[model samples]
Target: MSHAPQAILARPALLFLVLVMASACASRPGTDTLIPFGATVPGAKLVKLLVATNRSGHEGHSAGSASTRGELRFEELTVSIPPQHQPGEIEWSKTTVRDPLESFVVVERQPMNATDFQERLNSRSNGAGSTGIFVHGYNYNYTESVFRLAQLAADSGSLDVPILFSWPSDGAVAGYVADRDAATYARDDLVTLLETVGSAQTRRRRLLVAHSLGGWLVMEALRQLRLKGRDHTISKFEVALAAPDIDVDVFRKQLEVVGKLNPPLAVLVSTDDRALGVSRRLAGGRQRVGAVDISDPALREAAAKADVRIIDISSVTAADGARHNRFVQFVALQATTVVQADAVTSLQKAGAFVFNAAGNVVSSPFDLASRALSSQ
Candidate 1:
């Protein structure tokens, strides 16, 4: 998700200015100060939108807010003016030098509902439009999630739609259980966020990018959402799970559910993710959901037999030597540009690729592939 440096600079400046204005307008904490939605800020073409997590929680080192006392909840919302860049400005990355493996950012954070989400979608759905919701893995703090997402959004350069849903993560190797439990507790919030943003009213092209434990939460949420609705609501949604930390069998079941909902969605798996491999060892050596082993002969048979798409991204090695963080580290790969272009193209075309048992690129439903593939 590439953006003109000038445009990127303009967004933060505007955000800084808005924060200042909002601070001046509302003297009390937690008061909803409405910033007009769907408006364009100076130097921006697309409307800048944002979803503020008013669900009370501790902001960094600050005293715990009431919202942070229990399961995180989304209470308030707002839509910011659009940034100068188009929707193509959003991106995702696999960080190697960085501690956090992956990240994403939307040029404009919008209100957290189906309606506001739709408005943002309509604004970006023209030529190179897309809508992507990123669910990050465990061991991440809020800042880590936002900044990485911001970079990804910038790198992907897809301006259609960029969203990052950050659950409470302690950013510690030992905090895996705590983070998983927290994500489970927040499952409903995730579902609500997805349904609200991906609903018919919104009608925007949507994708879910999940990593590690976040992958589990994403699959579980989608499974539960489909179970509640009986598979009618998930067909329109797409998913990309990277290095997920889930039991292999659980992942298989989830895949069966997803295949029934949508044709083999993109599942990026890696064999070199050290942390996840350790998790596999802890899980009695059973393969994990997002591991490269998912593409192994036996597993691939299962995947293909179930009509699921498992893309083995293991060839895209981590340049940073950071194991278990392929999503962020793989950004260093030569395919970065291709993947970025494919991202917007996939969104605009509303079709994605499927891999055979051998990990070969099969046929796709992408529209205007030549034009969309060219990084003009």
Candidate 2:
């Protein structure tokens, strides 16, 4: 008799218990801290974002518990990043009153109709600059997602327009199942956002970046577009998935439907991602795409055939303990134009590559083989 089935069943149960205990010991910020302070400080940088959400509003703030009448809503937000801000960190205030000089604060907010949102996006993209739409992962509230995009935009200094595609996440460690369902429920709405951006008359490039479960949502929306014979819409954007928590087989199936994108899809992966490690166990011990060993010839061959670029970032230290947020650090490193230029030059082709701790890109297989032979 095989114990593999029993082992697989026990792993998820064990992981759940461990996660519950960890959650109990974790310190979380108060939801009231999410409120906008509406203040500005000298030497602070401002990041303006076009926000679209399916989250329901409560007391003038988007609540994490409900959807917006089963439809998408649009808004514009301006976030103030403190002068003392550090890369790869979202500095939250310890007190209810946020200090603009020390913490990230929202200074301006404007509710917009769909028409106004598209028009504003069009105007921003009328020049040669690109638009970036970020989809936040699980365990994120509306304000958290908004500020995260703001941080990325402020740090990278690349995006002409940053848009946040905020889905309803319960924002609790124990609410993982609910967040998964919410991500699935928001798929059609995501397609709408993609279509809205793709239909613009402007010729500017579009970049869609999704993290963790948001990667699943983005793939599903792209698949939906493909099924509807709207491949052109999918081709309009460059895609990237960071620390995606998708099962490997499921990702393969998704890629089969997504087909070959013009610029291909860039997948930022880390073998040491503890969050994806937990996800893999919960998924019947199936491997997750984000945690796959990129140096494996099989994975490299598959990625090449599918027009995907696998970027292994295991060498970079993560700001978070789980090591699932190295992408933030990666973008922060790109803030230095020299590193940005070099990294882009190295990643122009579709295959596996390693982003080292020193902000250099090396061919993954070559790097690993050389290290192995040297050790031998």
Candidate 3:
């Protein structure tokens, strides 16, 4: 009789073990393959982005980062829009999702080039006549860059045609030197991309956004464009460099040339940035342009001469580990609000407050943290 009671007790223990194992398996996603964050909201489709990359794609994974700079190619992918998502990681629920960076799943993907992209762009009704190009920085693989551009586009909802210009970055912090050379080699290719876009059947609002080292590429490309007397061929929109990693002295010369284009060039810099500090050290004690305070006498004149407006976001709280790309966070947060498109002018109209060269002070700064994190 005692043996019978012991056996009965063991049955429940076995059942508990099975339940625990089931839960563990359920926790993991269906596929081991990385997917982009969040499922689409009910009755919604995917957010598509067109891509142009100079990185070699014949590697093991077609979407993997290019090992060497290759011929520039065009492709497109679509990302699902997760309803009620905040910037960065999310909780698992109907209203939220798991971290976006964990996996990069896409609803649809296609092979395309500049001509096909233009056709699709012409067909789009939302924010027509606006083409935004995003240049990624160091330490980004190809997949990561594409998904991020998708996230930025979906979140901003301002871009009519979202284009990702991904150069060959070694995708490692230690690979800075290699990335620099790679970016140099890709400079002319960037010009070609720009010219192709410029020659599109329709003229549109051309916006360029470069982050970190990619900002260096933008300056170089613009300088080249100006040198070739080709900068005027394409209509330009507002240019924003978020935590640019360009050398201070070099950036000044770049500003001298690009400023002639005279579309508002906004340098979104933060003094609290730690990544720029490392980049500064790498540049032999020279501070990167993004780390330069707007009040710094050196850059203030350049800003004034170039008609560049300094939006000092050093006061904004950073959720990402590195305080470098605060511009992306700001865009993501703005999407949460009922703000509509035309985001270039939205910065001033949103009453977010801008700081002049008075040492980059935010006049009447409001708490954007709580607002950014609020349940959407």
TM-score top scorer:
2
* Model 1 weakest lDDT span, ten residues long: 96-105
State model 1's lDDT.
Answer: 0.51
For candidate 1, report its TM-score.
0.63
lDDT at residue 313 of model 3 (Cα atoms): 74
Better of 1 and 2 by lDDT: 2
> Which wins on lDDT, candidate 1 or candidate 3?
3
- The weakest ten consecutive residues by lDDT in model 2 span 364-373
Provide the clashing-pair count of each candidate structure: 45, 0, 6
User: In lDDT terms, which candidate is top?
Assistant: 2
Query: What is the total number of backbone clashes in candidate 2?
Result: 0
Note each model's CA RMSD in angstroms.
13.2, 6.7, 13.8
**1-376: candidate 1 lDDT, tens digit per residue:** 7675446335543334334433432322121112122333454333233332323443323311122314433322222213332222222222322111121222333234545555654555555455667787776555445544554544444424567677766554445556777778767878877776665344445667777888898888888887787354566566666677888788778866655434345556676666666677656788876665653467666655665556555655453333555455343222233334444344333222332223333111111122233434
Per-residue lDDT over 1-376 for candidate 2, one digit per residue giving the tens place of the 0 to 100 score: 8886456436655456446535532655555554567888999999889988888773365342343335688988888999999976787776767899998888877889899998988877777666788999977766678778888887776676898998888776556777889988999999999999988877666788899999999999999999999988887888888889898999999989889876668888999888888888777799988899988999999888998888888877677766777788777765442433455555666788887656565322111112222222
lDDT of 3 by residue, 133-182 (tens): 88998777676677677667766655667888999887654466688898
Weakest ten-residue segment in model 3 by summed lDDT = 363-372
